[model samples]
Target: MAHLFKVDRVRLLCSCGVLKPITAIYFCRHCLKLRCGNCVSHEVDTLFCPNCLENMPSTEARLKKNRCANCFDCPSCCHTLSTRATSIQAPSPEDSNKTVARKVYYLACTSCRWTSRDVGLKDQTVATGGWSEQDNEHYKYLQSLLEHYRSVAQQEKLDRERKRFSHRKSAYLSLTDKYSLPSLLGRKSLTPLSPYAPKGDSSQSLDMTASEATAEVEGLPDEIFTEEVVLSSVTDMEQRMASPEWQPEKTSDLYPLHKHILVKRSLRCRHCEHNLSKPEYNPSSIKFKIQLGAFYHVPEVRMIRQVELKSEVETCVQVSLCNPTPHDMTLAFLPFVPEAYTAMQQKVEEPTDGGSLNTSSMVRVVDIPPEKTDLTPSADVALPQGQVILAARDDTAEYDDQDSISSYKDDPLVVAWRRANKVGINLLVTPKANVSRAKVGFVLRYDYTNTVATASESRTVTLNIPVMVDVGTVSE
Candidate 1:
């Protein structure tokens, strides 16, 4: 039986030759093909903090190393840290005889009950961002190494540009005619010298020393073997690894970590380079600007009940089909042919100039081939003959009491029942001799109404989609 948790029972074949459920795939209007997560391109559209809902620009995010400046996470539990304030009595600076109460803020994790005060971190005078950052002992050495590499890279780039410029013909050839050879030589001497040319004393120097490997190592302290260990005061591997710059072994060294930023991305079809899903620009909004999920554009198939299957025995299995579109649909079942789908993919037309220019104009370094999946069915399915008509979707049909089944004449053996924009049909399945789990597949040919009409094309088109259904295990 089809349940919300059992969506994998019925799967649809994606254009990349992978089998996926209808809810996990997308329908591209320009390419007229089914695309899955593996066959689509993802692009980050926005960067924002999930806690404060504050958006940051790309340059600012890169400068901050993709971390939220105003928010923090608990180092022990990795949860969002909340700011808590407390009041304490202190001697007044102007009047030593009087005592005054002042409020201070500290970070706390409600989940793990971890607070900044556990590690002896000083309370912040203000709530936003006054906490001190951890300093690395090798910071100066790392900066020197980075500067040395940057200078080397710059020198190589200059050499490459100088070589390229030397190969090109000089544009000042005509100027030599107006001036004598001596004057032309004098003009060349006034030009600046190439930076790549060697200069003995005037050359810039980088301050960096090469590192050498050594066999000398520091031994563990004698307290490790002489003193007893307390597990509660030690930090786990996960907590220590959270701060890689300074992996804290003891719970007293742990500090609050900066909250990482999250990104909102949009999906695009790889073949035609069209946007399949796009979210709104607002940071707090959950709605989408353009979403083309298969659930909204394709007919949904659901199994009615589980059935037992024996070898050479025809068992009736009921399945319901629901049309999600506003226009009426005419659908028919056809025999599934693996070879036909392969040939059809080869004949798929290339994208033409109809919309905006595609962004994938750069040459690719590696070209990936489409994946191929095995689709052999283990059971035989006796598809009902003729076509089935599903009415357009109506919002008020659920309130109506009158039966909508009497309007259409249907075969009682094939059509089990009829409802608004949905109909149930019976299928006959025969399992193979040694098959434990029965599986059947078929091609669904339906007339689709294209809402994106062009000047030279019609609004209706025919589409064929292959579907595979996993029936229950065969009965002995």
Candidate 2:
């Protein structure tokens, strides 16, 4: 209870060897192991603009430097800039005699009340595109650099392809390029290089001027030491760092920045390759496409109440256990001891680079460390020693007055309270002596039924889970 701010007392140890809350962990149905954020792999599902909520393709987002086209952020405040419209009366082009009213737009910040006019930016006749955009001064040189690198990469790829192709006997020169009608009809001819084959771009080179580093450094201003520093007139670090390409040092040079693109990612289990969490592609839709959270799959355990815990002394601790599954469960409690991470502490997923390591060498190599669970128990728990039967979940049973009361008889020492699929149980916790705050742990062995259709036999599988509870020091 009241564990929002402080949850170290009730952290659960994941398979990866990490201690975390159940809400932060995931249960892979295939592996049946607790996965924390560290052990899962994150794959970007969609790129979107957080400001405009517009979905963008990966290629388009890359081309735009992963920034939104329509949305802009205030340079001064770093807040989203809103388009403020003002009505202006102007002479109509078609009817010169008549004065027509039209709306003009300018970027403004609601938080700081900074407007485009403050920075000497002109109001636009049209809202979006009429705003002035700063082009990179070395645009041509940058394009040439890109072309030069692309050609070099292409040539390297071509060389690698040729080397690979020369060794293969299945690959043959194109018939159209090597053989002519005359050769097919009578005369034999030597094969020429195929026209479709990649050739080196001899003309591709950098178009910019070359310069080497010199001993001389650029001189600072003559009045640098004497000049007065005005904080309001200078841009903050955030404003300058907002646009990395042009880090404006002064407020006068500050410009509206394009909003950076946001991405939705899907998490997958590393062991079984099962999707743990997947979000919908639509930016506006908040619902998830597939979310297999540990909270929904595993039995949630929470500390309800605990008696005084003296060092090497017997104490009573009350905890509420809820079965998230829809089927009836035969629950058992157990102690969990946390150990060091061989593969980072459980809950953390191993990162994959989308490539397999070459294992054909003299020694087989693998990146991830082995899993280690050889941890000493911090505390001990006294269990019911037998199976605790819990009935299947009934949604309507909560509202029914007749069914609201539990008919199942419970042992006085074990079951403190029971409602629906949730049961409150009391267990004796004994902590090690001299340890100020010893964490008591238990191993819960339960009978779980595998309902997956691919399973050969739908039978009750015994599952053992380790749980830990924090017990503070008790006075003599």
Candidate 3:
């Protein structure tokens, strides 16, 4: 009589919608799918080293020579061998230190019965142990080698410094010329002065009177001094020479005024053959540091209903500006010129109250239909509009080494919105009169100087506003 046998089973649904019972199915942890070995392809499980297969602790496995100690295989037949321990006589106490003596174990396969004694084996001590003491000695040997190389490097550095100083001294002395003191004194004494005695008074006085008469005649003008003035005075002597037509001639006296002019010629470098004339002293053309800081008063955005649109739309945005500097500043709206517009048109006018003025004539304006005029209900209404996508923000404070004003133009936001969007949208600012309802964004940028140090700062502020448009029915 047999006891009751229970069968374990799993129900699986196939792709064809049929449910079937599965027996002896293997669970695949990798694929998370059950498989009958017949349904999937598989290779035979290969035997691995027992030390590698047993889930022993990692520290114990490292000490075992990375192999299974108990199992040995025949090199010829690949068969497992059995271990056989044999006890041999230990050495006497007097000779124990002289010879390393130990009892050993040997292995042999049952099929071949290959005994260790046949191989001339003996018992020996095994280091079945703690931390190996050999590592300390090896570390000390490496440290000594490192010190030897370090000393050689220091000696080379000193020798290089001495060679550099000697070369500089030799070059300096070769460029200068020096003379002895005795040769210099002999050259100074060679110059002589006149040693003629004065003549008798009457002869001296006659010589002085004749010299005075010659000096007086030389002081007269050329026209008064010449005597051969005649229209037909071209004798044979004058005919052979060029005619002295009264054209202005540059005299030698004028040459003294221009004697200081020095002519410079281009020179080339002897080694590199590069032209040395006007070589750039500062390799980078940057000259000055433009310190930029901005403090902006918050701008106000008001929704105003204009006279031409069909619905309540944003009309005008007002921005107030104050120049907190001692001197007046001319703020330049470089890329924010009013002629650049998307949809609506605009015109700028000066405020008659003398508060702030827009001198430009190109402010944009949107036309509003005259029917729906009320914007009183929706003051803070969320307008279904997409936000203006700005480029990455880069604060100028992070760039301390940039010393030129032109570098500010390369700022991420400035290059993306101002420069790249040049043809897409119109830029408007405050103090612009007759602004339209369709244009949405306005930015104000200016430079201001501090009152104390006169250090100037730059600021840019943007405003997003709503414009009111006239819809045909006031209720809708």
TM-score to true structure, per model: 0.79, 0.74, 0.17
Model 1 quality (TM-score): 0.79
lDDT at 42 for candidate 2?
Answer: 65
Any runs in candidate 3 off by more than 4 Å, and if so which?
A: 1-24, 27-34, 37-54, 57-66, 95-102, 120-122, 125-476
Best by lDDT: 1
| Candidate 3 worst ten-residue window by lDDT | 252-261
RMSD of each: 9.7, 9.4, 45.1
Put down candidate 3 lDDT per residue, 238-276, tens digits, no spaces.
Answer: 222211222113211010000011111222222222222
Judge candidate 3 against the unseen true structure and give its global Cα lDDT, from 0 to 1: 0.27
Best by TM-score: 1
Number of colliding residue pairs in each model: 0, 21, 28
Candidate 1: residue 389 lDDT (0-100): 86
Worst 10 residues of 1 by lDDT: 172-181
Local accuracy of candidate 1 as per-residue lDDT tens digits, 279-349? 99888999999999998888988888877678768899988888999999998999987776665444433
TM-score of 3: 0.17
Query: For residues 1-476, could you state the per-residue lDDT of candidate 2 as single tens digits?
Result: 46422556666667766667788888777777787776676667888999889999866886787899989999888899999999889899899999999899999999999888888888899878677678878787767766666655545544544654566443322122111122222111212232255475466444446668899999998877899999998888988888777888889888888989998988777666678888998998889988878777667777776467777887888877788778888887654534433334434344343223211111112224335543455557676666677766777767867546667767878998888888888888777766666576777677666555655665667877666666555544
